[model samples]
Target: MAANLFVIEAPGKRQALAQALRAAGVRDVLVLATIGHIGMNPQGFKPLAIDSEYRELAYRLKPDRERIAREIEDAARAAKHIYLASDDDQEGDVIARDVMRWCIPEEDKGKVLRVRLKSLAPSEVRAALAGAAPFEDASAARGDARRIVDRLIGSLSSDEGAVGRVQGSLLLELQSKTPVAGVMTYVAPAADGRGDWTAQLPVFAGAAVPDEIQAIAPLAVGASRQGTLANHVMAHDEILLSASLATERSLAEVSSALQGLYERGQMTYPRGKHCAVTPEAVRRITAIARASGAGFVPGLFTAVREPGGEHSHEAPNPMVIGLSLNRDLGLLPLDEQILVHVARRLIECGVPCEVQAPDPQQLRGLPAAAQGLAWRRRDAKGAVLWREPIKAGYRAWTSEQSLLHFMSKNDLGRPSTIVAHVSKFLNRDLVTQDFDLTKKGRDWSAHVGRLFGHQNLSKIIENYIEEHKKAPSLMVADMIEMCGLNNIPTDQQQDYEYEDFEISTGNFP
Candidate 1:
């Protein structure tokens, strides 16, 4: 009997998805993994193989992936139905398109379909296969355009080292912010005797400092402020940021762990841009929270529903509601920790809390303090004093969290690509883990600013693609020429050889 063939990107997901198919009563299905992009431009921009008239580009399968290609072809030849079950992102669309072009026989193309496996749960998998559609040609084109633009930027700015449309802009943005030097710390005793809480104020250099602080001081307490702990459910970037903070792991590590859990069907798609939760998801999560004895105000639980683009999915949430984070999942320690944080965020988003803090009006016009040390109210002899907090509220966000929030607000990158772009800075040794730009990073940022004129070139390219529905090679070429790289000797171009699969801009397959 011919089998139904399903192709996916991550090898680790093969077993889980196969099981899902079985649970869904899907029979005689063969699951295979492409690992990742099967093809890439190994020789840089010089030999990118663009057609002169239509500006179409060609890409070939990587040499090591030839055997996999053969396997896919062989499987396709015998399969009753071929489902390209890749991710729902641009990269995934490109992979599906590539598989269609390189592996599936032309005669069998009629039976080939694209299925977006957002999660490996039985229902989702069954639904995806049932509703399978044609590959997203526009998304694949966007992905290809990004690849070409990034490669062109890299090759043109090779002297700067590791320049990218988004990465370069992000590096410049990071460089613009100044790190705090010191802070003023104030300690307050809890009136009910639970414990003492502290409030801090940023202190800058050149602020006048009093010689002695009062031993005891009275600060005006502001009215109690009540709200939910977290304003909304965790989005992709927020999950990465929160997990990084809770685990003290690098974003790259957190991203990997999240991806691992996602592939295992332990969670929903983790790379979604929007923070919205479906009404059904909200009901499920609320039920789980109640079952776990988590306290949350029903009235305060706002169901966040934001409009999203075609590639967007709901915010990250556990696939199996009420599943134990510890025993049931058999997750690695790091994965468990990350999921725990995610669960906490989900619960807190629905929980209400009140905060009290010292009134800001009373602390206005104080002397500027340093970044590391606290400013205190002391006696004439420089003795420190204790004061109760007149105001209570959430603690200040950490520098890393603030950076992530800034990136999210500025649309610096998509949820799928934000952490990777941020990680690239650290990987290239251009920025410290603290997000401070190194000398090399600063120099690169300067070079990019000079060449690209400080605009968000990535957004420009993205907007162009969204509107024009094609690669902006001509626009990019013009930009490069404006950067004074119009002319180059033929001898300077590097050479390489590979099979070519040409795609036209006017009409794509």
Candidate 2:
């Protein structure tokens, strides 16, 4: 009898899954890999007009007809049972669906099978091949929607200048959903901070840094100076994902933001990425949110970024991967101080952080000390205005470092991550990407972009970044609309609502 043949996309993935399945007592299965799909549709924003029955999404397959023909011939000549086990995301779904079109029997529809597997572990691989569900057309359809969105978005160029790169589509799907629909990100260092990124040990990572300030030191610094955040730590930082924040919150702002959480009773110990929010906290926070007058709440939401149940997985988050414990131990930068703050803020808001809720009078009483720091703001022409913070609560300095990340020509994640993260965004459709600019990000990037001549010659360049700091009035509304956000919290006015704070003029801290 001919060996049953299974074809998957990636060689490594195929090998891993194959070994696991073999270990699970499947002996006759021959796992082969095409590496990837030979056939795919060219990407675009315009949807292929289905028959108006909504049966099919409008999309085009790729230009690789010859390759598709070769794949079909190979599939036909191989084992009697052909399985198309591609990556488990839309791109993979599309690949399987396309491959099936040629190899599967038109009448019985059983000759070819599309298998979905989550990971290469033995049980999952065995379960996947054991004949459960075929490829989901809905998954394929959603894939089509994504491709169309991408095509539309590509003109927007490389998913940049947009907030929530991962949650880009969600803002569209969840226009009228319940309370809040938004995107959040979960970012991690490529690896342990030292010699090899794949290295997972803590000791080497800590010693690799120049300062020898083990990750523990940074966390110590954060915990020690918790005074910086003061009261707002008690107020909610109000965001969901760490991934979307890279562009929005810098290292400084993140550290500054978490201080507010330390003041709030929501987090037990600030900072981590455990995805560890418990059932109790979720329930409690959801109720408080409903009572706080923000309606449209969902029953309970999933913390989507949780990874392997393995206690060893380390990444920056609300409650695990402490900068003190992991990242800062290696040599790092002040920017990491900001990331530390972000981790703390994420932890505080992950479940239900107790906040005093900024009161306008009290906010005014909080020092408005935007003062002396060594930073530069330049026009498109490199004309620089150094903004020295002269007051507390006043912004200390201005620079356009963020523009380097957002405006640069790189899409941050690979095909797999992009699909997974975006899928999460699509499923709930509650969140928008972190497209809305922080007062600093927008000012710095805009100035630096024009100064560096990165902008196309379409509009006149002007540096009015502070105008964005206006009350959550018409301008704020306009910004919210453009960024595609909902669930306007009451504290929206704290930034623009306060004209001047009570801090003595020229106060640095």
Best by lDDT: 1
List per-prediction Cα lDDT, in the order shown: 0.63, 0.34
- Per-residue lDDT tens digits for candidate 2, residues 1-509, read 23566666655444455666677676677666555665542232122222222223323334445564455445556556666776555567667776666544454245566766544434345556664455545445434444332322222322223323223322322222222122111111212221111111111111222121112110000011111111222212222223224335443344434433322221222232233443333444444433333221222234432222211111222322224312331254434444444443323333221111112332232223211111111111111111122221111111222211221113222323332343333233232232333443343334334322332211111111112322213333343334333332221111221222232222010
Error of 2 at 277 (Å): 14
Whole-structure CA lDDT of model 2: 0.34
- List candidate 1 segments past 4 Å from native: 22-25, 46-48, 51-58, 121-130, 160-162, 179-187, 190-226, 297-300, 304-309, 322-332, 354-410, 413-420, 427-442, 463-468, 471-496, 499-509
- TM for candidate 1 is 0.75
lDDT of 1 by residue, 1-509 (tens): 24899999888878788888888888898988898998765454444454332243445788788899999999999998899988877788889988988888988888888887756655556666677887655557767766666655554455555556777767766666543323445554433443343546643223332222233234444455666656788788878876775577777788999889888877777887667765545666677666666665556767555322356567887766754433322244788777766775676677655545545554453333211223222111111111122343223435445556666656677776776555454457676645667788788778878766777766666666555545445554544454453442222233334544332222000
* CA RMSD of all predictions: 8.4, 21.5
